[model samples]
Target: MSLAQGRSYLAIPGPSVVPDAVLRAMHRASPNIYEGELVEMTAGIIPDLRAVARTQHHVAIYMGNGHAAWEAALSNVISAGDHVLVPSTGRFCVGWGEMATGLGAEVELMEFGTKTPMDADAIETRLRADKEHRIKAVLAVHVDTSTSIKNNIAEVRAALDGAGHPALLMVDCIASLGCDRFEMDAWGVDIMVTASQKGLMVTPGLGFVFFNDRADAVRAKMTRVSRYWNWTPRANPEKLFEYFGGTAPTHMLYGLRAALDMIHAEGLEAVWARHETLARAYWAACEAWGQGGPLTLNVADRAHRSHAVTALRLGAPHGTGLRRWTEHQAGMTLGIGLGMSEEGDPNGDGFFRIGHMGHVNAHMVLGTIATMQAGFDALGLPYGAGALDAATKVISGKA
Candidate 1:
């Protein structure tokens, strides 16, 4: 029998469970787009948005998703023939590099496998070798959503400085913005890009790009800056309608306002802490389940694991079956293992991901782990017992 519930849990990596407060805020009748309370209300969001990013830079709002933010960030600071050193931790980094390539920039990629974090020393070595400093920027993903690996942005900044490289340090924070601890200005990030869906707890469609003065300087020099992607008008809009270079994404703004309020109420620090705590608990649960089984964490080191998501390898076909059983029988949705399987292991037959970011609490996390454990048993997958007990102890502060 399934757990016929009042609400279906959307536990995938993104488009997370939106708060009712945010939904209610967005459900109202459409407000005037050109000049109205929505405009005035949105003006108030910049400071708070900067606060969440821990940035003192200028922020540009876009009427698109994370991919758009990536393009916007690239468009503002780079031109054709510009070289960007992309240190990819997973698929998203490669995606960002692809964007740069499409935009006529020369892309140099540094892959750290699917499960490993970017090696700062390796990055430093590469930068030092580029004596001409042709690498105009280093695009780093703060948390790679596909592989569930969190790179140390600050360390990458330090590596750049230590090597005396003048590359702009751009970060993709789409998956980690509100869930992980990120200090944009302090970390020397020239540009930070994110979307509303993941950790910000809002629906998709809105993307944000935060740029420091250094990036602004670069923007000023770009003779070919696309008017639509230009940050100047969006950042200091005299009329709110110009914020999007057109009609604003009104409902998304309302949802974002509510989501930001929820984040601030809990406090960014506390939010990060909660995610970290829950992530640890989930890891503990996974460790217990894999004790005598084929399941194992994709990333070997716990320190490199992402607070927003966890990637697991459950040994071949069983992994796919387990996820299907959980969703079909237990009514739990698990994230598909992205970028972890090669041609031989296609269909993500041996991998799965657990999304523990945004609008998730202890009970929701516990229930997810419990259901996954049930899936293992139902599928007759090899595993040890006591997974739930271990997870509960972590949540309850008993272990």
Candidate 2:
């Protein structure tokens, strides 16, 4: 009846499967918090983390999740009545705009629905219409995990430039950091926020915000910024305690260091390549499966879908049914179709996502697809045959 045992794979977008080395690194007893190895390690890892982000800008470490990083980024750059533009592709960016509203900022929301990517032409149109340039910043999501849609950060920057807007470009790379090909500096990203749990192969509890000189100037102009959330000291602290605001997250630091090392060892370019290859294989399988059923990828264009995650939909209750069968019967977990409940999306219950971000290999992907095919068979669901063969060809370099 049930066989959920052994090391079950967590195929959700964030909080990906942590590596054994990272776990062992965090398994040690609490280290010295005042000084010595902890302090030294913190100093060393910050630059390495910056390397992963493709940024040489000021990096601030926060003892919070992606939401905390969002708050911190807002507190530093926004005043009480500052206007901010949010081109939302999914629920999270709109939520970020809400956080800005809570912070007393006027939010100009441009919703693109849950199944589409952010439109740069639409964004440019909005920016061009703002004659007063009241918008102080633009919050964008690089890869919205909920929809598995990837928005181009470079196009956003271009839109702002085309309109001669000086608003800070803040990007939420929470689900795209190490997995997607994001060049913060090259792409003209001013403030980039991310978490350690997704592609960094580390456990949660750390959020990072990287800011450039332009964003730094904006923060300096802000008349009100909470001391607790200020980025000034944390980015360039004279003492180790200032870097974290108190006794450090000792074990988390160890785990982060180990994860960063793994990223570097694999080479960032190759890491991106691996994720792309695996994503293609998953797409191959999904396209085959969707041929004979109501299944369809939320983002129809493969170009817009995130290589780190893929969202799909079927008829009512099938998504949940397949997810349940995979979890209990095949010992695998999938991401629920998030943000699919808004108006006009009556098939909300038919959505699910597969996360193929960090710590994922070809075998793991093949096995997951194999298990999914089995679930389709067991459920008597119609699916085009040769799904695994298609996946295997792609992974084996034949496709």
Candidate 3:
């Protein structure tokens, strides 16, 4: 008696649900790559991107994913033998450090584990220890999707200032860009990276690197940077081809234009509030379920949690069992517990993530919660009562 016959929901963190408007915008025939509407539309996109990041700085568009943005950002300011400090909160931050290491930079990671946010005080201490100031940059992730932990970027900036360190404040906003509140200019971020998916409500393929004058100055001092990854031409292209180093990602640009229009129409602040409220609804349900069951949120503190995603631990087979039940019985998919492996449950079968990011609304979030409750009952997994009531109250603004 399977009931999974319908349009399914993808509840993963990245590569989030694409808006129909974006799809319609991208569905047209490939336009002239050389000029015309594509070029004009792209010109408009740059300013809107700046608005989304709350930055008046320069941005380089790339025809790639978040990983490409990571590599592209590191390529410009980091050269071989340059020292970069990474305050790793979870998998993505460590992964970014590894990318820097691959580029021949000396990488140092300050591990903060998975459940908690990066410690600003510890970061300041590390910066103070770098007396010679060999560290050229500090790679920070605004939010690690895997752990569902949001680090304070402004505090990281304050740490550098407190230590009088000259290291560049480079941040990865791939997971938090539109969903969380970020002010790149206000936070004094030298460089920031994000992708078109997730909070942007566009399909994956476009990556962006936003840089201020300070970071561009570092690029100027670099002995050599790969021509393809260089930001100068991409940021201030003389022609259309130079905008992407070659052929532009035609459809993605259109999709991005539509997505950016959507963001601005709703207002960035309002979008952030929407994600925050939906996230709270999901959290309320999880908290209720955890009261009498094995279910628990990975990040214990509400202030440290990411508005885009919520990681949960149901313990061993139950986590895997619940995920399977939801997708098979109901037309919904849940995110796997990424980079959350531990003793006993080596494969991270004890965890799952709920993505409450871009293009998501109250009904969608509430429906996911109700479906999960059904999954628990169907799988005979013990859960506390009033889960729906708690979630609904939050959504209804009565909690």
Candidate 4:
């Protein structure tokens, strides 16, 4: 008998579990769009948003998702013939490169296998070879959601510094924003892109682009930016319409404000610590289960994996089977192994991810782990015993 009914849990990588406070905030009737509290709230949240990004940079709020933020970041800084170096760890980085290509930019892709982090040495070597500084930007993701690999943004900055290259460093923080520790100003990230979901603990539909003055200067010089995509008016808007492209993302504003309040109340550093602890608990549980089984952590090294998401693989049908059992039988949803199979591996259905990002606590994480073990049992798959014990120890500070 399946117990899939009741309060369901979503353990997917993004559009993470929304807080009730945020939901309540968004549940209000339609606010005045043109001029009112929505406008003030939109303008007021910039500094707090920048604080979350760990940057005092200028921010442009886009009424779309992470993909829209990607487009907005690229649109403002790059011209048609610009060259971008993409250190692709997973599908999202490759997808970003594809966006640049669509924008008439020549993309020089530095392929790092799905599991490996970007190679700093290779990046330095490539940049060193660009004597003409033909590469206008280096587009990278802080954590590739598809593969669960976290690249070192500071190391990328160091590589650029070592090469003395003038290319802009544009980093994607879509998956890592609030869950991972990122220092935009300290790490020298020129431009950072993210959305409202994931670590921010808000529903999808709002995207954010944060950029330093250097990125602004690039925008100032670029004449090809579309009117809607340009950052000047968005950054230094004379009215509310300019803050957003047109009418504001009214509900998202309220939701984001509530989420940010939650984040700040707990403190950003503390939030990061909570994510790390919960992620460790999940990892310990997964590791134990993988013993003498088809399951394995896609990212073996603890140092490289994302705090917000963990990618795992099982042989062939088991991976798909486990996901199905957990969702259909256990009332919990796990993220599909995106970009980990087919081109990355022979079996496309052998991968899945757990998203334990924002608003997740020990109980929620432990419940998910327990459900996964139940899933294995339901599928008649042999997994290592004491997985729950291991997970509990981590959560309780015993492991």
Q: How do the residues 245-359 of candidate 1 rate in per-residue lDDT, one tens digit apiece?
A: 9988889899999999999999999999999989989998899878988889888898899999888999778778887887878778888888778667877888888888899
The TM-scores, one per candidate, come to: 0.98, 0.98, 0.99, 0.98
The residue pairs in collision within model 2 are none
What is the C-alpha local distance difference test score of candidate 4? Answer: 0.91
Q: Tens-digit lDDT track for model 2 on 212-244?
A: 999999999888789889999999998887988
In candidate 1, stretches whose alpha carbon ends up further than 4 angstroms from where it belongs are 1-6
Give residue 74's error in model 2 in angstroms: 0.6
lDDT of 4 by residue, 1-399 (tens): 879999999999998999999999999899988777888888779989999999887999898899999999999998898999999999999999999999999999999998889999899999999999999999989999999999999999999999999999999999999999999999999999999999998999988899999999988898778988887898898888898878888888999999999999999999999999999999988889888577899888999999999999886677788899999888999998888775545656888999989989999999999888888887888888778899899989898
Model 4 segments more than 4 A misplaced: 342-347
lDDT: which candidate is best? 3
What lDDT does the true structure give each of the candidates? Answer: 0.90, 0.90, 0.93, 0.91
lDDT of 1 at 104: 97
RMSD of 1: 1.2
Model 1 clashing residue pairs (backbone): none
Residue by residue across 105-194, what tens digits does model 3's lDDT show?
999999999989999999999999989999999999999999999999999999999999999999999999999999999999999999
Candidate 4 similarity to native, TM-score:
0.98
Off by over 4 Å in 2: 342-347
Off by over 4 Å in 3: none
Residue 295 of model 3 has an lDDT of 97
